[model samples]
Target chain A: MTGSILEIRDLRVAFTGAAKPVRAVDGVDLALVPGEVVALLGESGSGKSVTLRSILRLHPENKTRIEGSIVAAGIDVMALSGAALADFRGKTVSMIFQEPMLALDPVYTLGAQITEAIRKHESGVSADAARKRALGLFERVRIPSPERRLDSYPHELSGGMRQRAMIALALACNPKVLLADEPTTALDATVQVQILLLLRELQRELDLAMIFVTHDIGVGVEVADRIAVMYAGRIVEIGAVRDVIRAPRHPYTIGLLSTRAQGGRLSGKRLPTITGSPPDLASLPPGCAFAPRCSSATSACLEAAPAAVELGHGHAVRCIHTAAVA
Target chain B: MIFYASKRILFTLPIMLGVTIVCFALVHLAPGDPLVSVLPPDASQVIKEQMMALYGFDRPYHEQFLRWLWRALQGDIGTSIRTGRPVSTEISKAVGNTLMLAALATAIGFLLGTLFGFVAGYFRDTWVDKAASALSVFGVSVPHYWLGMVLVIIFAATLGWLPPTGAGPGGSEDWKWNWVHVQYLILPAVTMSVIPMGIIARTVRALVAEILSQEFVVGLRAKGLSELGVFGHVVKNAAPTALAVMGIQLGYLLGGSILIETVFAWPGTGLLLNDAIFQRDLPLLQGTILVLAMFFVVLNLVVDVMQTILDPRIQRA
Candidate 1:
């Protein structure tokens, strides 16, 4: 964990409004080293988003119960409060959301939001200086006519430009870590690759430890260095992106990888789909969440949720039968 | 922004023209005769015709409408059949009073409503939301004139702390800014305010809930803004819709104040309309209706422009 920018240990997040608390994130252990890009690969409701949001304490306080340690840039995230917590966000860590149209404030201009973020964290920064920094960030993101676009409202910009503005906003305070929640999912296919490249470029340039959440495996390959396959509310597998993709040990990850039309052999053939849906977090059964849909399931896999079994070179898999998928 | 505002304003021109036509047509369609109260019951045909000609009632409907429109454009709404004063002069005075009363009431309603709305919306499933929601419902459901009378009984007739009726001392209708005139304003303004208060509170509560649920609100918080800063953003998002509701409510209060005005004996357009209707004062009636209708048109124009300025999305639409 030395030189790690952000570390989340056994992080558990639950929402408490229902009859039973829904365990959105359970026993998630993750760390982001300087300049590392990790893609939390999962389908919808897999806790990928929940884990990303927990870092900034973005969930409603009254509704959510978060336990375990989340430390970023030497700041204990779970313990910080009031002004300190506020200062930590957009300063030590910042986030860019999936839908740029929904994330950017409709009423405020892009320039104003960026300047506000900059000025908010550093009280001594002059408005003019903050605005100049905002323009710089806009230019760094390669927005067209950064100055004019600065005054433009969210609705005035196209989706890709809006996402660029969003990235600019997130980077305004120069945070050590960036949490992107499916940042390019809401974009056009053409723009998606461009944004991925830009994000990858910025991550390298800023040496930001980024946790990129995406369901798209193709997107993961474009930007992420490591991949953490999430199922239900757990990270079932984690390793180098190349290793996870090529040598997936967990059955769920294997099924996810198989669903893609890899090349010529899969052309004109119906893509394979993982059978059965994700387990309901509110009433999860007493077993590995993927066991119901896993083709390699055994009675042992149904006994309890498997623990992480470490492999060489930092690859970890949580499975009673790791060799079954491999 | 200026161009958008100008475009919105230009769009209101056709609406105002339509309003004038409806006002003229609706008033003419009423059951009572405009000349009945002023003429003798057994007047000879010759005398009746002469009186009718004097008032321009002898002309066809289209001709009469054209003449009225021309004279109205020239700031001559003709003379009141009952009072003998110019209808323009009477209407202007009444409009001033109504504007003052409605503006004060709407301001109070808007402030209180927005406060309650934010409270309720922010604490959506809590006791504070219940209380604010209940009060808002009470405000909406209560008959305004009944509330006026009840308030009159409690604060005016029983305690004798304030006057029950009239716009000033000695029943004068002049509205000055001093406390004496302001006291006369309180009873009617408070009674009238509840309607908008309830309507606005409900409107704002819905608006706040919707705005707060939007991803931008979380985005604001994620950007390191304090709760207060996030609240400010929510307010800006809620303002345009809230203002639109308030503007429409203000229009209602201005013209729809007849019952409240009658109950309080406040000499606003409502009382003037009642007097005009009872006395068969066509000129005064027409003038009052026209001005009130115009108020609505103008208020809508102002709201549209203001909304465009407040909400960037509205400008494009």
Candidate 2:
């Protein structure tokens, strides 16, 4: 009962296609305790979003092959079927997306969509009760003029407001686990900070376990308590947010930090980036997926996949030469 | 909203007027002498001249058009040259038949097409989807007359289950809403519906598939909406596109009914149009064509308004 609110064990997601299966997520494991926010930080092809989606089994069923055990709020997520699976969603685990305009149905008023989600998971809830709950969620998310905003369609709201509405909808059921896939990536910078602060405040108030997926290290630092840096479908390093930022053990994580530093304050300096592009998942290199890009790659690093070496205080890194590199 | 509607109506007026002028000119310029058709082949030159003058065919083209336009404005489309009856009366009767046929066909086509499309899109790349797609493609390619003949051969000629032609049996015009009339309508209606149904199915499948792949769909599913709920959202999101396509298909059905009515001997405007063309009955052809063109324009307007209502994005535009 005191374990992590969300536990994902050895998750592997491969998409079946015409030629060969693309391994979007490969042997990734993560867990989130109640009231904790873990940011899955990675570049575009790093499989951060795919890992988040796999938690809810949201990929197209026939095309996706998911092999893992996902337990959310003490429920066996991988074993749920039909109505049970749907019931587990939103109430037990809810998700918000990057683009609010694309996430909210254009034809429906915000109020209707939220209330319907409330009523859907709770069978006996009356329409009026659901609407009241929806109103409260809107206010909790700090959407201005919630009553009038409820009647407005998705397109009527600005980008930031729409994202807030999306958050309100995701929070309608008071889920224990919230999976946000780049939720603030599409908003303006100022709006992004406001939303991030709002999300942190809500997460604390509700004591919800959240997995925030993002590519920006800056945003990750602002919100996450712990950070899991993924590279080429695997977690390269994971630790407390400060620990990962202060002294990254994995080379890829180090490269990401360097780029962030280059983008801020040191404007005129040549931006140091990872040497090469991420390896194609369909034809990944043997040993470490990051070997070609790693500046510290060795013969041993290229021969076999490195084991995840545990550091003290729950810190871990999957690299053969962590000591030498550090 | 009222202003938008009024603007749309105003736009249609010029288009309808243009259609009437074109229809009148085409019928007049056709290589046929109304007087020769009306009078005897050996009739005296005086008799032929009198007939032409009486019908105003001897007048200048602009004068004839002006006279027709004036009469049309006063709610008189002139008398049919073939029947010698008021064109308005003939058109009214034909309108009823055509409307009944078109409504039935559109309803059947839209429902079936939408259902098939939903299945195909929801279970994309599966056997059900592939089969539905193939069936729609076949439906689209088949000619209406050919399909009507096949249906007649199967249902009427071989099976002897239904009548092959006509709105109803003789002396049953007053009872056109009876089961006998419905029995006679099925063949032609099915034939008329095939192409539209196919078109709708294809369009709906493509649109629904696209919508289902959108990020919002994933967001909805992640919220734990059941598969059925997600499908419901998909359909609602895809409706405006489907409806827009249906409106266009209905216009096509109205025009295609001409050939279908002839093949089945249905007493619709299509049949009337066929007869008018053969007889070179300029007034009847002009009246029917003008009315048909007006129906299409109005149908399109209704569709635009309905789309705007369904999707507020279009309303703002």
Candidate 3:
């Protein structure tokens, strides 16, 4: 059996409103092996991003209540407290944000910021050593003139440089797991490819377990070893990347693939269109959240939530009609 | 960068000149002559005419302005009619007193305010923030003169802990090292500093809170930084704005000292200007106004330069 580097089981997060809680991430389960890349693909409201934030306990205090078991590198993250949790966060896992522009403080130079990240995780290290590590990371990420660029503020650098700096900062501590939340969503097309390829190269070189979150399937195709398609707050499908992309079982997954394949032509071909949007958690229907929009949805799908079915090997589909679809 | 500072200072020169011209004309336009203010009401008209001519007040406005400007260029601010001394000497003495008072008060206010602000902002929505916010509102709303009197009533007159009026010990002419004089300064400076302190605390609280919420802060936390690490960067980054706010407050403190100085008999520039106004000593009034305007302009220029240096984004712009 292969050992998994990170495991999140039955994670549920919600915000308390006037009375009941608004479910953000409900019953999410995932596992990542070392040097593996998993793509969590979802639209804006699908709770994919929330799951990533939950792992780090980074939600606003008092606004979110998280209940789950997240074991990262043999440590139970949900049970860690204070300095221990901080220690775990810096050395065990690092995260990169979507907006590279806002991911760095405006006042500090890029070198100072990255060096700060290093010093936070490793104590008693001199500034010279930390800066040396920072320069190395910068070069690894392909930043030009690492020494000269270190003194430049985030505003002074271009978008690509800022993203690379952010990557350098994230990689400073050599975290075991790297969580990237739509990392390249904010960059231009050319810069996006550069950042994505750099992340892939770095992960391969460092043997890092990475969970890449994005709504765009195109991004998932480039670097994802496995893909988990989320709908509303549930994972509708999880399987090997090639399997899911080649022969998607869940109707929602099929709908997504077909619609995106339509390629901006409204009249050229009869393009597939999925009807309706994701359900509102506060007033959700009793059955599958995707039933309202699924073309092949049945009365059973509308009456009761479907259980996960193992199609073959590691592929799983949360729909009763998976066998028929296959 | 040097060009920016010089450009800002050059822009301020015209504003200072405008202030001088308007104030010089307005003082001249006021009812009654300076001679009437200095001499007995029943003095002979011939004597009054002679006094006005001697002072160049009898000349046309433009000619008088040119002569005053020329003398001012040579640092001859003229003599004060009331004190029978050079206006420059009177102003320098008063400026020294006022600057000492304002500087002490501002230093205390800024230090305490920034400390309180960082705490409140760090523990936002908690009891600390609530208490600090309340103090800020009170500081901003309460008049400085009223606060000064209340302080005097409590710490000086009623308690007899310190003197209600007068400045530092060993006379205003020289510096002294006395603990009592320093202690006596507490009430006046504290009273004068209330509003500025409040303003700084509020500004720092807001700036710290904003910085604390930025994406880089989240990144810092994710990098395993303790709360202290996150807060340290937040404060360092936010300090430039806090310092800028303090600078503006310093200028306003100078403007605001008029009432506090008069009530407490501190004998600063504000009090000197008040006396000149009552005595209608035109040379003293004009000289004092010019000096205050120039001081404000210079202080603002320093603030601009500090801000530009502290914030790279501003310098780049």
Task: Give me the candidate number with maximum lDDT.
Answer: 1
What is the TM-score ranking, best to worst? Answer: 1, 2, 3
lDDT of 1 by residue, A1-326 (tens): 78788999999999998999999998999998999999999999999999999999999899999999999999999998888888888898999999989998899999999999998999899989999999999999999899899999999999999999999999999999999999999999999999999999999999999999999999998889999999989999999988998898898888898899877898888889988898999988788989999888889988898999998888999998986556
Candidate 3 — which residues are off by over 4 angstroms?
Answer: A17-20, A261-272, A324-326, B1-4, B29-32, B43-45, B168-175
Candidate 1 runs further than 4 Å off = B173-175
The parts of candidate 2 lying over 4 Å away from their true place are A261-265, B42-49
**lDDT by residue for model 1 over B279-312, one digit each (tens)?**
8888898889998888888888888888888988
Q: Best-fitting candidate, measured by TM-score?
A: 1
- What fraction of native interface contacts is shared by candidate 2? 0.77
TM-score of chain B, per candidate?
A: 0.96, 0.95, 0.92
lDDT of 3 by residue, A1-326 (tens): 24999999989888774377778787898999999999999889899998998888887757788887999999999998789988988689889989877878888889998888788778898999999999998899999999999999999999888889988988888899999999999899999999999999999999999999999999998989999999878898999999999999999998889778645666677766787878887666778889888777789988878888888868999998888887
Specify the highest-DockQ model's number: 1
User: Tens digits of per-residue lDDT for model 2 on A205-276?
Assistant: 999989999998999999999999999899999999999999899988988898766446787787777787
lDDT of each: 0.91, 0.87, 0.86
Candidate 3 residues B12-116, lDDT tens each? 989888877886787888887777777888989898898889998899999999899889979998899987999999998888778877888899889888988
TM-score to true structure, per model: 0.98, 0.96, 0.94
Interface RMSD of each: 0.7, 0.9, 1.4
| DockQ winner, 1 or 2 | 1
